[model samples]
Target: MIEISLTPIRRYWLASLVLLLLPVAGYAEDSVWKPVPLGDAASWPAWRGPLGDGVSQAKNLPTHWSSSENLAWKTSLNGWGDSTPAVVGDHIFLTLQNEANELRLLRLDANTGQIERNILVDTAETPREAPQRSSQKFHNLHNMASPSPVVSGDYVVVHFGNGLLATYTLEGEEVWRHNLQSEYGEYSIWWGHANSPVIFKGMVISVCMQDSLADLRQEPIESYVVAHDLKTGKVRWFTPRMPDGSAEELDAYTTPLLVQKDGQTQIVIMGGNALDAYDPYTGKQLWHLPNLVGGRTVTGPVLGDGNIFTTRGMRKPLLAVKLADFRGEVPAEAIEWTVEKTTPDTPSPVFANGMLFTVTDDGIANCYDAKTGQQHWRERLGGNFKASPVVADGKIYFLNLDGKCTVVAVKPKYEEIAVNEINDTTIASPAIANGKLFIRGKNALYCIGK
Candidate 1:
């Protein structure tokens, strides 16, 4: 190499300095992938668990835990919320709302029940008059942070109903924020939005089903499912739920689930007055299952064994349809069957073994054959349940709103094993990870394990 002049040497030195600082400058841009350790056998990772199907692979989960026994640890939460705890590695994450309707995200160490970080997220806007007759009076039920946090590797995604979607690192550093309701559309409901966000293939998906009955003349009263880039807060795709409708009943609060069948990926959405499927990659409508009467839906659809199971919150029938039937404009025939009595109107159904287990909003737990909708046994577990049931290690866990947890055996015959109790009520679903159980009560987050 030939020696350069002083000026050129100075320029070379500056370039070298820039390169040395390039890694620091691009630290945010670098793909910082955090390996989420498998949770304890008694811990929960997300609203449901690792599979997002409400089933835990762990075998050593505690069968009983109460206010004074079998509890690994119980920590008082700062705010009120129905959002479930999401565990990733040794950390537990959740969202809550204080009395002022201020949203907050909290992370805790799974081992010691110590809070790692708690950050204030959003403050609810002033409440307008109730718009719908079916709306419940607003209470301190932590409605603002009802949607649970979903942890994907190092990043945790939280959705605050009124349209705030945010991503934070495991260390509680907020990466980016997006106000989808303000930017895309406002919520249509009087009860407040409660749809949770889901992640798949590097995309974070959310369903905006607003039912603004008072503002019937609103221009953009459309219901849609949107996907955003997980790393950057960029819109990837948006599929409108209703093409040309202004009906508030078409709005929903149900989250969509990703299903893969026959080498094709479909995002199954149950909302408003219809059941529909969409191409997850492009947000293209694939098929529709109409004739569904719209109402306030709380439970999302569950996919299993090539079939989709869904529930409409109102006095409607529970639906189960085969996924292959969506290949055409309309299915040739009705795929399976439906049950009206004792069916779940809130909690999502869980499929384990060859049986389908569901707990209704009024606390009725029923077991049915997954292949057919035939009921095996119906029993009242006593307390009301808004959270779904979780199956782990041959046992089914039911969390009721009264803070009672019933554990049953997942067999052909129903077997009530144990009824555990905590101090506070729990509307958020239970999560299982590594080998621990994470339960988010109205007043505390509990980690039950060895």
Candidate 2:
């Protein structure tokens, strides 16, 4: 196991200088699209579990637990971040940054919740200000470690708000790293960047949907989707993503979602007033549904029952778009149903058992039929919510900011089962594996199991 302690000598100036000297371009790798293999059923390896949706196969998950009851282990993690754990096999990968501004990655033992490996990935400061824009500030609730670590192949890719994307082995050996802003341009987003990278076939995909600065100058800053070689960190392909929106409407903190359908896979992204898909192998735009026209988006899209469900930013209407063999532009008829009331703004929706569940940042929970879009029930779960809900066993877990998890049945009707409290601040979403629940709080990581 590796442990890296933060020292006074480590600084961001050295890291920035090293990244600025690396090459800016590289040749594309093979174009054959081989999907990322789902290694184990008991692992929650990515942002939204194994399927990139918040549904877990783990059974008999504990529905009720306090800070002392049904607790497997609680390990105190230094510093703070709002990233969900990437649990694979017996290791849990997480990212955080201390007051020293040192971005770090820790691999913990799953059974004992012990920190097995801790590596200082990079150093970056928070509230990275734009040139002359004071209104474009990062929120106080999150920092550079807000983007979660993604485990792909034998490497765990971690990203920081400073545009530092680095890959390290599971054993804490560095593979390669890149500072995106050094190669591209400085970010001009309203808030901080928090988009987690997604692993596709043989490559890692990342999205940057931010302020174009078109409102400020003649030529707008480019927002693009870029793919890099999983093993070498070389740029494989880059597709410019200039959507038809302006001002804050152009900003998106949402992550890229990989959707596999009928033996074909597409990278689905929701932001910049549009929902679109891209070819995984070639970095080409596949199809787009334009004119979504919502404010800066944070809520991501979810797939269920042969349809894509998403909400526009700022509590806009929820959309249920049907899948099609679309070419250039998706037509208006592709929309199956829509619900305008009680939609979520920050937390992404979760689907299970033909029912979809969503909780607004204000704590209102709404259940809908996954296919018909009919509202089955709407109830308040209480407390503010920033974490997305996760479903396991026969219940859906709605975690609030106050570290309270309200477990409800997966049926259409609202049936509350248990309300568990941990006496900590939890904003990151929960991860489930092997019949146990993993929750990352503000100061500690808690494992709840029977």
Candidate 3:
């Protein structure tokens, strides 16, 4: 080794450079993935807001707003997607697919309604042979970008129906990506994969429930719940999830519901003729309630007041199961009550003010008491709906396919607050953040506020 003496000024500059480089090196070594701070009321960080429920803490949300009235700003999007925007601070992350089948992530300025960046995540690279004897066609209502982007700390994770799950910094820098089908197995779901990823405790969790093709082949495809490290894309755990069901009943297009009970965090999944919960860390099956099978699942589960509310599938009975001391197979008696009429098939139900609200795909809005499952009111909202309802400040907003939002108050009696309409077609569920409502439409992202 050779050493050279330097002047005092030169030594000082060299020391400054070393000091600046130290923190960068340390950060690279640590690679710590922070958890998103859900305490901030102004953030819609993931699929169903901070609590994995369709409830928003925002106040003064606009009760009446149209295309021109009470509009904050509207920014045109390049392509259409049913995935809702995930908002944190002043940044909004969304996913969409162009006509060329390019899956992309868009970072929008939440305050100004301007797209700050459009980063290509992946292309729809469906395998040449496709899966043998499996249906890969999604309904015309949604495409591959149906799964929404989720904000987890400084990184936003976007999932596409094509099995591409990617993470990027809020500034649109790509961090890591994985083709889940390549890692596990080909998707044999009847429609398409639209389950959004949820980030918890430094792990991004995803669920896959689909057709096993048991009748078509001697070997069956596996459905699974998987978790990956947020810092790296390395998979942390994968648990095979095969509920006892048949045919299309094995398929599900719903996202997992993250819930906490008795200080224990659980990832609740509803599909395949059953309802179950798993440990997010180890992907261990916790408790399951099976045999309530109906058709393929679309709506997800929601938790409110110590009860888990979910339907089997395809507008079956809406069951409210009380949170009890559950382990292994949850007994059938755990379900407290069921509402058999007007349950939603696509849009998930929202719980607010000791009641549960749901909008059927055919436009019937139904409200039931959270504890008793007694129907308080059932009224026709006059439009087809695919987006789930969001509740804020004691009011529920139900947006139909045609961009009509009927805001209703949370009361035992049916109380319609106001009906707001926009010209663009909307299929995505509404997102609330920073005291404003963000609606993703076929042509634009509209910000409505006063």
Best by lDDT: 2
- Clash pairs, candidate 3, are none
TM-score of predicted structure 1: 0.85
lDDT of 3 at 230: 89
Q: List candidate 3 segments past 4 Å from native.
A: 1-39, 125-135
Task: Give lDDT per model, in order.
Answer: 0.73, 0.84, 0.83
lDDT for 160 in candidate 3 is: 92
Q: How many residue pairs clash in each candidate?
A: 26, 0, 0
Q: Please give, for residues 57-78, the per-residue lDDT of candidate 2 as tens digits.
A: 8988988898678999999989
Q: Estimate each model's TM-score.
A: 0.85, 0.90, 0.90
lDDT-best of 1 and 3? 3
lDDT score at residue 138, model 2, on the 0-100 scale: 71
lDDT assessment of candidate 2: 0.84
Residue 426 C-alpha lDDT in model 3: 91
Best by TM-score: 2
Q: What range of 10 consecutive residues in model 2 has the weakest lDDT sum?
A: 1-10
Q: Superposing all C-alpha atoms, what RMSD in Å does each candidate have to the true structure? A: 16.5, 12.7, 16.6
List the candidate 2 regions with Cα displacement exceeding 4 Å.
Answer: 1-39, 128-136
Which 10 residues in a row give candidate 1 its minimum summed lDDT?
A: 1-10
